[model samples]
Target: MQITTNPEGRTILVGKAIFTPDEVNQGFEQVYKDNVSRVKIPGFRPGKAPFKIFASHVGIESMKEDFTEIAARQALKEMLSGKTIRVVGNPTFEVDSFDGPLNLTIKVSFIPDYELSDPSKITIAVPKFDVTDADLNKAIDNIRGRYASMAPVDRKAKKGDFVYFKWSVITDGRASDRKKEELVEIGMEDFVKDFDKNLVGVKSGDIKIVMAEISSGQEPVEIEINIGEIKERILPNLDDDFAKTLHVENVEALKDIVKNELLEQAKDAKEEYIESMIAKALLEKTNIELPENLIESSVDDEIEKLARDLSKKNITLEMYLEKRGINEEQLRAELTPKATNQAKLDVILDDYSKENSIEASEEEVDQEIEAISNAMKDARRPALNENDEQVRKNLARIIKRRKTVGYLMGKVQLTEK
Candidate 1:
């Protein structure tokens, strides 16, 4: 057998597996032996049939097709062994010309070779973050609101008042049967912006309807609220007593706690922002040829993930697409860029891991699993046991990726902004 490869694209390969007449004869003989016992032929008992008779029973063309299939599959499998290319699914086989040299063409799709940009050249300006007095004051205000006392008021509803009412949400002119009581904190636009507009200045027992747009898609949802009761919140003065309520020594201690919390948050946000900038810079600087099939496969995986998330919320993918006024093809098209970027990023990271010798040792992986288990309060910890082979492999891969990214991030020069 003789094999040759031709490139249709950067990631698409057309492999020509030209078999000798002797090899073709051998393939035919093997196929006959494998199927002879199951094949029926007149005037003979199963395996005892003559080659001519068997060929006559199952047409010569069918025999040749079987021979070609077996030989092509074997040749492609042998050619792909030990190759670095990540094949996407199975190859497509086409018989170019069986009459001459038993020629067969196998089209294989794979991720093409890619090289990441030098990590030393990648630089990002990471902002220096600190918790200021304003941040502490903002946090204190939020805490004070949470501890505020609410008491029933006979007067009309006003800003900063808490209103208890029965709400019915209407969508596309259809009223939902899921009526429930809800509370709206007046003047807190984040809680209910439209509610304050229609509920303020209204006395108890007043019924009001408000049209609010939540989602950009579909018609505006109509909110019907039946005012049940009104209450005004009384906030305690921020002093030593308020600090004691939060288990702190005094107001000074509370401020310190809030400042520390804010500082930690600022640090986390800065790290995240730097990582995102690094990813964006890497992608922009590196050039990779992605396989079309791989992108499509990634898109399918994304769609499946979306379906699972929606299923958890008791919604179907079809229902979501329908509500968004899009077809499956359109959704796939919209997700193409995301899938492409993810595929390319995976290839880049894999290459980086290999070049830098980044690896996750067994001890490191075990420690990671233990840390995760300790952090989780629910049954989720058991789902990542080191005893599970797949879980361990996944954990190792994740750790390795993190190590690679961390190495790259360390190499990057950060310009403070």
Candidate 2:
């Protein structure tokens, strides 16, 4: 085997592997022998056919094609061994010849060459804040609200109250009969669009009409909401017994727990905000060139995921395209930006991990796997117990990436919310 590297561009590496005729013939023979037990002919039993007859029946050209594909994969794997190539996309291959001397080319893409300076020197000032007594009181109030009960009120529906209504949406004066009994939780954002604003002053037996736009650039659509009943939330009195119900000895103990919980949550939120700030700062400072092949591969993966999700709902890719009135090219173009952003993030995180020397220990990995297996068992299920070394390595890599993100969070400044 002869290997030569061709520099297509700065970020793309193309490898040309040339295999001798003897090597190609050997591969073909191996494939033929493996398939002999499965291949059937008209005049002979399954595994009793002569080699020459079977080869003639299957056709030498087809055999050569199969042999070349397998050999090319092996050659590319050999060429990529022991290299720290940040491969961002699937390899592209081309066969220059299938006979005499098999010549195959493989293209791999990676992020452009870059370096990171000392991350420890990157000082960040995190804003600090203290949890107040008022915050604790508010948290206690929220906890009481969770155990609150609702009773039908013989009055108007106000903000912070529950309203049951039958609603219908119309687009351009045409009624959309999608579903009849879709329930709307008044204050929840997942309900009707800006439902709080629409339901604030609504009274029982009152019909409130509102107009809302679905997507940006789309025209406003009218919705009719007919309230059936109104309910007011009634909370239990905050006392020592209320605290005991929460497994706390007294009101003071409950307040202390709430205060600690709030402080921890505030710290976590601050850390998250700082991590976002750092990512944006790093992305702006970095000038990395992304290969087109990487973007394309990412888009392909995204589309495949979308297809799988739709399949769960009995929808096919062609059905989605027809419903949306879009061609494959248009869909690809629309998804490119999202895919590019994901690829950029992957490159950035990988570089950051290497610079910070972030790694997951074997013990940490084993703990994670054990935790997953235990969770599965508790759910009365079985875990994926594959003995494949590659599967274990991949899981370890995922855990390490997660840990790397956590490590970066520790290095930045956090401001309490």
Candidate 3:
């Protein structure tokens, strides 16, 4: 076998591999022998058929195709045996000349080679974050709101009141759906802009006709709502009683727990913020040529994740982009920089992890896998166990990346704001 490298672009290497006829003949014979036992011929019982007869039945062209494929894969495997090419995405192959010495061309993409900025010299200043009294108070307020009680009111509905009403929307001279009981918070514009306004000051048994322009470039929807009961939410006081409801000793204890939790969250946020700063600083300082395929793959992953999230809300990515008056191309273009940065960060982190001897132990990987498997439902447990190796590697990579980020973040200087 002979190999020649041709540069396709900045990050892609096109390899032309040519194998001698003798080299591929063995593979072709092996493939033929492997399939002969399964091949059915009229005059012979499967494996009893002569090689010539089977070859004649299957056609020589098919054998040549098989030989070309096997030889091309072998060439690629040989090329990557001791090479430093960090090939990323799937490689593409083209059978150049399978008639003679099975000539094949392969295109492989790799992350570009570049040196990272001196870690010791790099310094990132991040503001010191702490949970403040106001934060704790806000958290307590949220808890109080969660434990709020609702009481029916006889007067007109006001802001922050739950207004239960029977409503029907008439679009295009026809009522869209049957009259349904709907509850809306008077102040939160969960519906059209004028919906909350129409609900406000509506007394029980009042019939209100609201012509609302919910969307642009469409006729106003005629909505008829029969007002029902109004309920005002009364928040419980943040005192010992409320604390007892939450199984806490007292309000003071609850506040302490909330403050400690918020402080821990703030610490985590601070670490993440500092790590992002370090990444940005390192990106700016270093000159790296990222593989286009890696960036494209990352962009695809982002798009898929966005699609899944939007799917949960009964929306498609196309619908979202259309609502925003953009196309898939525009979305991909917007995500390109982010994807590029992510790819660069991954490469840099991997390199840093290796250089600094940062590693995820087997126990750490096993613990992560166990946590993940436990989080999964019983139905998916078997699948998780089946993909144990892949899961371990993915978890190990995540752990190593975090360790690398933490290492860099630890080196940065923090300034309190």
Candidate 4:
């Protein structure tokens, strides 16, 4: 095998590999052995047919195709042997010829060579976040709201009230599937075209007509609702009785628990903020060239994730972009920079982890795999095997990168505001 590299930037290596017949002929025998029992040739039983006769039955061109494919990886490996470069993502290959001397066009993308800035010399100041009264109140309200009671009122329906009504859509002259006594929180439930908002100021025993787009690409239809009653949430006071309801000693003990939880949340937020600051500062002074295929793959992943998230809300990414007065091109343009930054961050963290001798142990990987198994037990999915080397390496890479981020965050200098 002979290899020649294209003279270009180090981000990608475009090269040509040519394998001689002697190197490629080693593949046809194995292909024949593997497929001998899988194919049916007339006048001969499976695995009893002569090699030449079976090859002829399967067509020489098809056999050659399989043989060439089987040899391409070996060709690539032979080409990259003794090279100092590390591959970043999956490499691509194109078969140029299947003749006596097989020609292949290979594209190998490697991680870009970059250096990390000195952590001690870095200057990034982030605000010291503190748990405030409002934060504590919000957290406690979250706890109280979960246990709040509802009471009926004779007044008009308000934003936070639960309104029970009978509703049906009128199409042509008929009402279909009329639902009665359906409950919906005024500001919480998402109804068609602010149907809940139109319920504001509604009194009992009143009939309300709302225009809603019930069906896609159809004209608005009139939805008639017969009001029943309005109920409001009454939050319990933070007294000793309320504390007892939550199995706590008293309100003071509850506040202490809440405060401690809030402090933990605030600490996490502060570290994240400082990490973001560090990323920005380092990126400004860092110069790195990522592989084109890696960037494109990352961008595709971002768009796919966005589309998937929107799908959960019964919306398409295209519809979302159209609602925002944008197109796919505009969406991709907006996502490219974020994807680029993320790709750069991965390369940066991997390099830093290596430089600082940071790595994930086998025990750590087993713990993660065990956690994954526990989480997926209910889904009935196959559990990941801890002994799988590839899975272990991938999990190790993730853990190492996170550790690298935490290390950098620890070095960040924060000034209290």
Q: All models: lDDT?
A: 0.84, 0.78, 0.83, 0.83
Lowest summed lDDT across 10 adjacent residues in model 1 is found at 377-386
Which is the better candidate, 2 or 3, if ranked by lDDT?
3
Best by lDDT: 1
Give the TM-score of each candidate.
0.78, 0.69, 0.74, 0.69
Candidate 1, lDDT over the whole model: 0.84
- Cα lDDT of model 4 by residue, 1-417, tens digit: 787877358777777888788776667787899898888999888888888998899988888888767777776787677877878788778989877878988888886566788776776766767888998999998899899999999999999899888888877866657664578788775655456787889987898777877654467888788899889999888799999998999999999999999999888887778788888877777788888778888899899999999999999988898777788888888999999998887778778888999999888999899999988887898899888899999999889978898888777565655
Residue 195 alpha-carbon offset, candidate 3, angstroms: 6.0
For model 2, the local distance difference test gives 0.78
The positional error of residue 398 in candidate 2, measured at the CA in angstroms, is 3.7
Cα error, candidate 4, residue 400 (Å)? 1.4
Local accuracy of candidate 1 as per-residue lDDT tens digits, 1-417: 888887897889888888988888888888788888899888899799977777788887888989988988887987786777778777889988887469888989987666679888888988778777787888998899889888999999998888888878876766577888878877776544454677789889987778866555545678777898899988789999889988999999998888888888998898889888888888899887887888888899889999999999999999999889999999999999988888778778888899989999999989998888777746554435679988889999999989988888899888988
* Model 4 stretches astray by more than 4 angstroms: 1-3, 7-10, 17-83, 98-101, 117-128, 168-181, 192-196, 208-225, 276-286, 296-341, 363-395
> Candidate 2: lDDT of 98?
69
Please list the residue runs of candidate 2 whose C-alpha ends up more than 4 Å from where it truly belongs after superposition.
Answer: 1-5, 15-60, 63-90, 96-106, 121-130, 152-156, 166-186, 212-228, 300-335, 351-358, 370-395, 406-417
193-302 per-residue lDDT for model 3 (tens digits): 66688887889899887887767545687878888888999999878988999999998999999998998999889877877788888889888887787889989988
lDDT-based ranking:
1, 3, 4, 2
